[model samples]
Target: MYRVLIVDDEPMILKGLTVFLQQSGVSIASIRSASNGEGALAAIREELPDFVFTDIRMPVMDGLALCAQIAEMDQKVQTVVISGYDDFTYAQTCISYGVKEYLLKPISKPDLQDTLRKLIQRAEAAKPASAYLSVAKMDEWMAEIEQAIYYMNQEQVTQLLHTWEQEIATYHMQDEQRIEMLQEFHVLLMKKLKARDVNIELRPLLELKQGMSFHTVYQQFTGSIQDTLDSLYRRRKGKLKDPIEEVKIYIEQNLGSEVSLEEAADLLGLHPNYFSVMFKQMTGETFVQYRTKRRMEYAKRMLGEERYRITDISYAVGYADHSNFTKTFKKYEGISPSEYRQKMGI
Candidate 1:
C-alpha cells in the first residue's frame, strides 16, 4: 500500500482527485490534500508521502517551488504535475525538479492509474537495504556518533557517518525497532548539539520508515547533521576565529576597563543581538558573568600581594569604588576580601 498527497487550490479538484485515485484500482494506504505548496511541503517534512499529485500555480507557493524545495530538502517522492496550462516550459521545469509525471488538469482516470502503476512498480523494484549487524553493533555506532558530535569532532563524525552510510543497508530489524532506531538517531543528534550549546533547528529526517529506502534515510540523517556541523565549522573558521574567542581576547587585554558588548560586536562586524546569542552559545556564559569572574580573579591575585592595598587592588581590576568591589567579590567568593586575605595569611 502506498500513501499519496493531492495538492490543489480548488476544493472540488482536491475532492475529485481523491475520488479518482480511490477508483483507480490502485492499492493506496492513505490519501491527503493541501491547498498550496507551503502546506504540502510542511506535510511532507512532518511525514513523507510516497507520491505527490500537485496542481501548478497555487497561491502561497507554486508547484514549481514545491518541487524545487522538495529536491533541496533531500526527500524522494514521486510527483505528478497536474496543471491546466499544458505549457511545455512548465512541464519541462517541473521535470527538472524530478516530477515523475505530468497530467492535464481534468486528470484522465487511465492516466492517473498508469502513473500509479509505474510509481508502485518502480518503488517495489528498488529493493531497500537491510542491516544485518547485531543490535549491539548498531547501539555502538550510534554511541560513537553521539560522542563525536558532542565534542564537535568533525573528522571523527565524518568517518563515522561514512561507515554508517554503508552499514545502514544491512539492517534486518523488525519494523517497530527499525523506526525506533531512526528516531533514536534523531534524538541523539539533538542531545549532542545541545551539549555543545549550539542551537540547531532540525526536522527529524527519518519520519516514515515504510516507504523510504534505508539508504535514503541514512543519507538524509547524516547529511543534515553534517550540514549543521559544517556550518558551525565555517563560523569557527570565519574571518579570524569565532567571534566569542576574539571578544575573550579583547576582554583579557582590557581587564581594567569596561567591556562593551556593542564595542565587541562592532569589532566583529555583528549585530549586538547576534553577538550576544553567539557568545552565550559558544562560552556557555553571559558577558557580564564572565567579565565579573575575570575581574575577581585578577583582584584576588592582587590581594595576595603585600605590596597592593585592597582598595588599590580593586581599582587595578577596573572597580573604582572599593565598597562596590567588596560587595561584588563577596557575592562571587562567598566571603569578604579582608576575610579572604586573612584566610590566605597575606
Candidate 2:
C-alpha cells in the first residue's frame, strides 16, 4: 500500500480529503494539515509520503515552490497540484516540477479518485526497478552495486550489471581513485574464492564497464560470485559421501548394550536391508561380520586391562549372551576369549 499525505491550508479541506481518502482504496498512513507551505514541508520531510496533494496557493511557500524544494529533497516523491484557478500556465509550470496530476478545487469524488489512481501508477512506474537499492538509497552507487552482487535475484544480475557499467563511463567519478577501490574489492573476492578452491573465473574488471548504473553492474558481479560459491559447496559435498565409512564411525562410537542393525541404519538414515547390502558391497563383509570384528577388537583392549572377565567383556560390546560371544570369538579367532588373552600374553 502506498503511503499518502494530504497537505492543504483549510482545515475543512484537509478533513474532507482525509475522510474521502480513507474511504477510498488508498491506505492513508498520515493526514497532515498545513496552513502554510512550511508546515507541509516539515510534514513531508518527516513522513516522506509516497503521494503529496497540496493546494497551489499557501503562505511562506506556494505549492509550486514547495514541489521544487521536495524534488530537491527526494527526487522520488510524487506531487499532485490542487488549485481553484483555471490557469493553464501555472499548471504547465507545475508540470516542469514533475507534478503527476492537476486537480481543480472543490474536488469531486470521481475526479479525485481518478487523479489518485493515475498518480499511484505513475509513482510506481517512476520508481527504481528494484526496491533493494532504490528504497534505502546508498550514497555511493558502488556500495549498492557491491551489495547487489551478493544478494540480488539471479535474473536481474546481468541487466543491472550492464546498467552500472554505462553509468560509470558517463559519470565523472575520479577514475584513479574509484578504479583503485574497485580493483581492491575484486582482488579480495578473488582471493576468497581461490582459498576455497572454487575453479570458476570471474569476469575481468575492464569487461564490466558497459553498464549505465554502477550499483546494478556490481550487483550482477556479486550474484555471479555467490553462484560460484554455491556450486563449489555442492561439488565438495558430492565427494564426501562414504556410507560404509560413515556407518563404521557411527557403529564404533555406539557399540554397547542393545546395539542393533536398525539403530546403525537409523544413524545413517538408511533402511536396514539396503544398509546391509551396501555395507557388504563396499567393505567385502556383511554388517554382522563387521560388528563381530569390532567386538573382538574391543575384547582385545579389555583383555589388556586384565580387570574384566569374559562374561563382562561379552556384554560390554553389546552381546547379551556370554555363550554367543564366546562361540563367535572362537569361530573367528580359533580360540576362546580367555585362552586367546593368555596366549597373546595380555
Candidate 3:
C-alpha cells in the first residue's frame, strides 16, 4: 500500500480522480487532494506521498514546475502528469523532470493500473533486503561468540564465525543483506565486549569503500573479529598471575583491620564481581572464609602467649569485640576460646 497525492485545479476532477483511484483495484494508504502545485508541494512535504498525479495546466504553479520541484526534493517519488494538452512539448518537459507517466485528461483504467503496478515494483526494489530479515534470530551466534571470547578461545571463535557464514550462505541471503548482517553483528560484539571491559577499543568491520565485493567486506569483518579476540586474549594472559597469593599476603599484613571484597578488588584494579568470581575459582573459598580461617589460626597461636589477653588477641585478629570473636571462634573450632586454651594447656 502507498500514499498518493492528486493535484488538479478543478474541484470535480480532483473528486473524480480520488473516487476512481479508490475503485481502481489499487490499494493505497491515502488519496490526498491539492488544488494547485503550491498546495501539492505543501502536502508532499507533510508526508512525502509515494505517487503524485498533477495536471499540466493548473494555476498558482503548473504541473511541469510541480514535477520539477518534486524531483528535486526526492527523485524516488513517482510522478504521473495528467495533461489537458496532448502537445509533444509538454510531454518532453515532463520527461525532463523524470516524470515517466504522462496521461491525457480523459484517463483510461488500463493506463492507471499499469502506472500503479510500475510504482509498486519500483518501491519494492528500493527497499533493502535486510528489511525482510529477522536479526534477532542471530542471538545464538552472539551468545556463542561471547562465551568463546570470555574463555579466550581464538580457535573456537574462528570456527564459530565460519559456521555463521555457512548458515548465512545456506539461507542464500543477498549481498546487501549480508552486508547489513555484518554491521549488526559488529554492534552485538561491541556491546558484549564493553560489558566485560569498558576501555576496550573497537572499530567497525570495514571502511566499506566503493566497489568492494561482498566477499571482501565479509573477509575483512571476520578478520577484524579474530584480531579483536587475539588482542583481548593477550591483555588477559598478561594478568594471568595468581592474584590469590597477593590477597593472602595482604590479609596476613592487615588481619587486624576491616576490609571488604570491593576494596580489595579495587586495590588490585579489578571489578568486584569479576575479582570475586576469579578469587573463588582459584582458591576454592570465598574471601571471608579464607580470611576467617587465617585469623583463627593466628588466634590459636596467640593463645600460647599468656601475656596477651584473649580480648587483646581478638582485636589483633580483626575482631574489635571479644564476644563476636568468641562466637566466630566457636563456630570454626567447635569450642570457645577458653576451652581451646584449656585443651592445649595454655
Candidate 4:
C-alpha cells in the first residue's frame, strides 16, 4: 500500500478528506495535520511519506519551503498543492519545486481517485525490478566498483556493463541528462581500465573526435548508474555476513535458550541444508558442536563461583533441563557440573 500524508490548517478538511480517501480504496497510511510550515517539516522529517498534500499558504514554513525540505530529503516524493484560487505564479513555483499536481480547495472525489490510481499503478509496475536489485546485490556491486577503481580490472568494467543493462531494462528512463551521465561513466571506465603506471592509452584518446565533449560523452553512459545502483541495493535490503558468523553470534548471545540448526539458518535467510553445509565449510564445525563448546565454557566459569546450584548453572547457559545439561557437560568436558565445581575448589 502507498503511504500518503496530508498537511493543512483546517481540521475538518483533514478529517473529511482522510475519510473520503480511505473509503475510496486508498489506505491512508497516515493523515497528519500541520497548522504551519514548521509543523509540516517536522512531520515530513519524521515520517517521509510517499505522497504529501499540503496548502500553499501555511504560516511559519509555507508549502514552498516544505517542498524544498522534502526535495532535499527525497526528490522522488510526489507533492500536491492545495490552494483556494488558481494562482498561476504560485503554481509555477510549486512546479519548479517538482510538485506533481495542484488541486483546488474543494477537492472532488474523482480527481483524488484518478491521481491516486496513477501513483499506485506506477509503484506496482516498478516493484518487480526493485525486488531484483536487492540489498545484497547492491553491496556486492559497490564492492566490485571499488575493486575496479583499485585494481583496474577489465572484469569490473564487464560487470558494470551487465548491471547497467539490467537496470536500464527495468527502469523507464528517457532523459538527456541520463544519457549524458552514461557517456561520462563509459569514458571514466575506459580511462581507468587503460591506466598503465599513470599514463593514458593514446589509442582511446585518438578515438575521441575533436568536436566531442569528454564530460558530456562520459555522462551519457553513467547517467543511469545511480538509479541502477539504488535499485540493486534496495532489493538486497542489507549487508550480508558469513552465514557461519551469523549463527555463531546468535548462538553466543542466546546461549541460555534452545537453538536448532534450522532456526539459525532461518534467521540468516538461508535454507537449512545449504546453511548446514556452508557453515561447516566455513567454520569446520557443525552449529551444535560450536554451541556446545561455548556453553561448556560458560558452565565451567559458573561452576567456579560455587554460589549457584548446579541446576541454576545448567539453565543459566541455555539448558532447559538439568539432566540434559549434565549429560552434555560430562560428554564434552569429561565431568559433571558438580565435579567441575569441586575441581575448581568451590
User: Where in model 3 is the C-alpha error above 4 Å?
Assistant: 1-144, 209-215, 233-256, 267-316
TM value for model 1:
0.38
- Candidate 1 positional error at 235, Å: 78
The model with the greater lDDT, 2 or 4, is 2
User: What is the alpha-carbon RMSD of candidate 1 to the true structure?
Assistant: 19.0
TM-score of each: 0.38, 0.36, 0.46, 0.37
lDDT (Cα, tens digit) per residue for candidate 2, span 202-287: 55455555333555445655665656546544655635345567778877886675567877777666567556755776788988
Superposed on all Cα atoms, the candidates' RMSDs to the truth, in angstroms, are: 19.0, 23.3, 22.7, 17.4
Highest lDDT among the candidates is held by which one? 3
lDDT per residue for candidate 4 within 1-346, as digits (tens), equals 3567788888887887786565453434566667767887777778767778888777677878887777777545788888887889988988888787888878877677677766665555556754323323333454466344333344565667566556644645444433444444344444332331122221222243445654444443443343333433444354423446667889889889889998987786555655675577678788788888999998888788858888898888988888999999999988887887778787
The C-alpha lDDT values of all candidates are 0.75, 0.67, 0.78, 0.65
Ranking by lDDT: 3, 1, 2, 4
Off by over 4 Å in 2: 126-346
| Candidate number that wins on TM-score, 2 or 3 | 3
Model 1 stretches with alpha carbons more than 4 Å out? 128-346
List, residue by residue over 1-346, the lDDT tens digit for candidate 3: 5699999998988887886676444445689999999999999889989899999888899988998898888557999999778899998988989888888978765577677767766776787754443333354567678667656677788898788777677555678767866776676577656654554545577567765667787788777777776676687774533456878888899889887788778666666766776688778899889889999999999988888899999999999888999999999999999999899887
Global CA lDDT computed for model 3: 0.78
Residue 174 displacement in candidate 2 (angstroms): 41
Clashing pairs in 1: 130-169, 130-170, 130-171, 131-170, 131-171, 131-172, 132-170
| Candidate 1 structure lDDT | 0.75
Clashes of 1: 7
